[model samples]
Target: MASGFCEDCSRLLDEFCVYLRKVCREFEQKIRDVFRELSQCTCFRIAPESSFLRRRRRRRTQELLSLHLLCDDETQLLNQESLHALSRLASSEDTDLQTTAAMFYLHVSHHLKSSLPDAFMEPVMALLLSTDLDVQKTISLSLVNLLAKNNVCKELVIEMGMLVPILELFQSGDAAAQCHSCACVTLLASSESKSEAIMVDGIMPLLALAKSYEPQVQQNATWALLHLTQSDWSTRILCEVGAIPVLVLLLQSSDSQVQFYSCTALCNIAAVREHHPKLLSMGGHFLLKSLLTLVSSSVQKNSTQACRCLQTLSRNVLIQEQLMELDCLVPLKALLKNSSPVRRESAITLLSALSAHPPNNDVLVSEGLLEEIGQLLHHQTSVIITHSCKIITDLCGSSMGQQAVMDSLCVSGLLGALLSPSVSDETSLHVTSCLYHLVTWDPLKSNLSVTITSEQVSRLVRLSGLIQNPQLSYNSAAIISTLAMTEEMAQLLRPHYITMLEYLLVFLKKKDVKLQQLGILTVFNLKKDGGFSSLLAGSELEAQLWKVHAQTEETRRLLQMITPLSPSPVDP
Candidate 1:
């Protein structure tokens, strides 16, 4: 039996390639007739000998399929061949081929849409509207991918009014169709500006679907919201349609992924300046309180959303005050003390935004929050310290905050942080800036005794000790200059002036022009208390000053041409 079946299969294989490559109308009809006959017999349950022939027949069919694809010259011809194959499988009284043909239609239709004329789109759109839910969802999924590739097809799809079918798919009782609908919307939402149209198309009707009991469908819906809510208009639309309530409902989902993105979606929508008030109107504060709970619970995802939500909350002064009223500061301040550096940075950020309000600063100060910020001045990362310094400056801008910060016992820690050797040059700048703000405070001057010690003074002097590191020297000079303006600070730093002078003079010995120039500036500043003459008293310092003054003048002359041309003399 096997031998006989093999011979018959060999005879059938001989014309397989020719049949597949045939282009004339009769050739296609013959191939369809052969496919119909082959689809009838169940070859799998036959005897082993006959099954061998069936396997050979299957191989020949696949080869013929491959040949048809290769022989087609243009995309339209290929699409027609695909349509023929689909027709055979769709109409033939064979289940397997029907399945195979459905899949074949999908594969070929995808390719044809790219290279074929715009005319082929109607067929693909027709597939999306099929009564067969599986077929509709599958092909609709593919159409979205094709249309999203370019604005031309995207516009065509829109003009074709096919989005309504896709939107209907979103509402389908079939979970598979619903998932594809969400996917389709995401593809359509790739353009940021057009997102508003998706909202106007009744997207809020699907919010409940996003919060559905089925996890897979809900995930897709949430993702769709993520993309749609990227636009401010969609956020407004969602809020107008009360989508926030559904989103907030999803926040309590047992699935962390759902809850995570749901909160993120909320944050994104809430971030819009216009929509922020709407969020507050729609219980935005409750959402924020939920975020605060997440932060306190050590759920990292929740903490991140909470931080961003706090930043969004910064846009509303009323909410900002409300945050204080809810005592939102406690968890955020707790984050500052957190072991995670990121959480601490977030805490600092919220505090900075919260402190921007004058009333909130009092709350922060009254709560002893200045010390928390002061501790951050010496953080391992310069960025944290930089922000911490800005916070310090803001806090010190108010008299109450200044007094609270000054009394925090971290003042010396802050000053020592400036002199700390391992921090980045940027950090040194921030530290000096904080000191600048601290000393420049009009009210703090009277209370500013020599709270900074001789040791801290010595540390500041050594900052300029390394002649090769000029940024350090500049920062130290800045710190000293600020201190010098205060009589008490100057008195404490006076004993160390000669050491600073020696460092500056040695720095001048180098051929660096800026160093030479700064040497003069240091001398000029030190002259405020006649300290220059004191350092120059040995005649050695005097000789060095004269040498630097000349070298400085020569360097200035060399740079004169590179300087901007002077404005033409005014006609007097």
Candidate 2:
């Protein structure tokens, strides 16, 4: 009996091969008639079908189907007959046939791409809603392909009401189906217009999927959440729905890709300042460690994003301390030298935040952060230069940082930066503050006067006169006061004495004690020359001098020297 069955199967296979040859010959009607007759032939579907017979029948059907569907030379382009057969079989009740048709459509649709008709969406959607897991997975993959092919299919998928059912599969389907479903939703959510609808129908399911034990589901869902959170409202919504802890937990995921998306989503959520505390409460320490790890690795894009996320989270002072304690400076310092300008800038920004606290300043200085910042000062980008200068200024706030700046000879860079015409007002202000700290370092004071030239002094006088920034103006006044202790600088500054006096008088009139003291000291330096004092004695500018508070006795004596001894004995 087995031998008889084998013979019958051989005969059926021979007939199918002959049919395939005729179909390939462009005899469209004849091929259709052969397929119709073959579908009804008893030999093809014999009684008491065994698994082997079923496999043979399906394979032969697929072979015959390929003739009408694919071109003879290329498998991608579908002939009209193959597309019609696919459309029909896609909705077939036979589970295996529908599965085969969906798989074939997935392969060919990639090639035909946008050329696939709008009507093709209906059968795919029908099969997508099928209860069979295999059929659903196959159709879900095909829909993802279609949606990715072009915007028209994407819109058609949404128009044909496929989004909700696919999202529904996230709950009922197995891991593979859930992954594909989340992937499709991820694709749809990428469209700005489609994002709102998917969020309405799918955000909760996606958030739930984000917590799945399966990594792919978590990856796809988090990726989808990443897109949805691009809008401010959606970001707030996600945070309110408590996506923060879940995303934070995903940062510990063993998969780097999962860690990446989770980090990015948390980064977006943390863009709003209010979310910072929430993220910290949800084990943000692990997030910091994960990001620092990514930065240490060689993946440039992920490292850049991780740096950005760290930059935002580091804004909180407590977090900054934690980052410092965790030795985040190592990775951040490495990123400072990164080839990517953005990552370098982000590293600089995070370092700037970390440097805000005095103890962190010591950590940064120990890490050679000043040299990195000095290198950044020469960067062609203005913002990098600006932030680099600001970080130096912050570091210089601590005494150890001051010695480090002076010892590193970053002072020359700071001076050059201060003199650069392209420097922003903020950058100029920071450079001036850095200079102020350097000159006040006592041990570095004389070195500064020696290293800075008379020409640079003249530039400082001009900068003090023209710039409108109060801090720059005040620090510039303080630097001149410190630098003019040398007679050479005093003489070089003599040429601009009137302008310097006018600028000083503005600060001398302020309620700020520091500015008043700097103003008095600068005037005292200029008064060293009997010639300048005599000049001060003669000019009408001395009237502004009377308003000086004489806060200290040195100020009092300096006032006495610059003030004409009360025209005592106007020897009339």
Candidate 3:
């Protein structure tokens, strides 16, 4: 009885194994049949009969629902049996089945903590080469989802040689397909190692699509190009491939997103100085106009970037002239008052560039830029103060600019910055230089006594003692010389005269030709007031001047006019 029971149990176990295998096979066959039927039924081309159309629509919906339900079961979804069935569907001749299968694969892959098996990459990439527009679109999107944030999957796709085919879609695919393809390329490019491969395979095709009439296509293509431009070599290649004209034209796009990306690409290109001439020759004026408009309107996202582009373009002298001709300072002055510090900095920077050329200085003054820059002196940020000071300093090279700066009454702000311990040495130099121009403006000589104060004079004298900053020291000495032209002003500076003359002697003894000349000029002006002249004669500065007067032609020429009353040398 025991042997008989054992035989029956063994037989039953075999039968159960056979039953399970048969069930799995039957289930898979049913899934294939449904997929085949769905692929064969073209809902778009269905018969016009109301009843027939309704039935077909219901059937398609039910089939899709059943597939979704199957996918919803996580336990069965990752099973080897389900994966095999899905792979077959992904490669099916029916486009609908291929799309659904690709999407489901992506969904499953996304949920898994570990990467999908490398074996699965082939069928997914195979589907990407599908001639069916719907299949290509779905597969491209699924690939993007599958490969996102997953370096292993990206490598697998590249290893399978899918990059070129994927890029090819951007050339011939419909708008949606092109957009999706561009997105995939962008994702792949995010991997620093993979960017070169994408560039090698897709750059030209991407450039072509940047000109597409579809705003979406234009945006995606330019975004991809923007990524490519991050590298120095890629930026050069982009310009070489004629991306500048295409990107510039896209600036006029009605879609702000398109405009933003295109502007970004052009901005990157503009950063490479070698590309500037070509960019300008290729209607960079339009680009300049577009950036100016964006900057003027103060579109927050693009405004700073636009300002940067303008700043870069402003390096070109011809471009500077053109920008002035276009009346760029009106918007730039408005930007200086903008609440955004970044916009303010960029605006000031562009203005500084424009102001570098002597001709633009008069325009800047005429446009009320001096007063606008003066307003920024109250800002708490150091860069704003520094750039504002720099613009004023550069503009002050001209008489009109100096008069404008004086007329605007910006000297007090500059004096404050010069005295502020928190200000950078560079900013101090700029402020001091600007003040030098203001105080030395011969036309404003009559107003010097009223325009400058005793406190400001004290600060100037102290600044002259800063041995580390020879330029600041020289500028400070020069301002004192101008103020000392009047007896009252000279008396106001008398308390600090000893320290001032000591610092001036240090500058006089320097090897730098400019500093020596400044020192001589300060002494010459100080002698204009008899009391200051007599004090200078008794001080040790007289010996230092005689010692330096023989060093260089500039010093000798400048000192020939100053006749110190005392001939005796002071003890060292």
Among the numbered candidates, top lDDT falls to: 3
Write model 3 residue lDDT over 260-354, tens digit each, in one string.
88778777777777888888875547777877887865367777778888888777788888998888877888877788888788777777777
Candidate 1 lDDT over 1-572, as tens digits, reads 35555776877876785676665668779899987676665763333357777895685487447535643544345455555555544554444444454454455545544443466566556656566777676677566556555513555565566667887786567777776777676665543445456545647556766867888767767777876777565566677777777777777777777777788888788677777765666454676677677667557766767687777777789888888888887888888888888788777777777777777777778788888776756565665676777777777767778787777644665676765667776677677667656766654543433567777777668776755666666666655654544565667667877787687777667776766666667666666776546666775556787887787689789879677856668852
Q: Which stretches of candidate 3 lie over 4 Å from their true place?
A: 1-161, 165-201, 204-220, 240-242, 254-257, 273-285, 375-402, 438-440, 445-449, 485-487, 501-572
lDDT for every model?
Answer: 0.67, 0.72, 0.73
* Residue 107 lDDT, candidate 1, scale 0-100: 57
**Candidate 1 overall Cα lDDT vs. reference?**
0.67
| Model 1 residue 320 CA deviation in Å | 1.3
The number of clashing residue pairs in each candidate reads: 0, 0, 0
RMSD of 1: 12.0
Candidate 3 has which clashing residue pairs, if any? none
Q: Please report the candidate that would top TM-score against the real structure.
A: 1
Judging by TM-score, tell me the better candidate of 2 and 3. 3
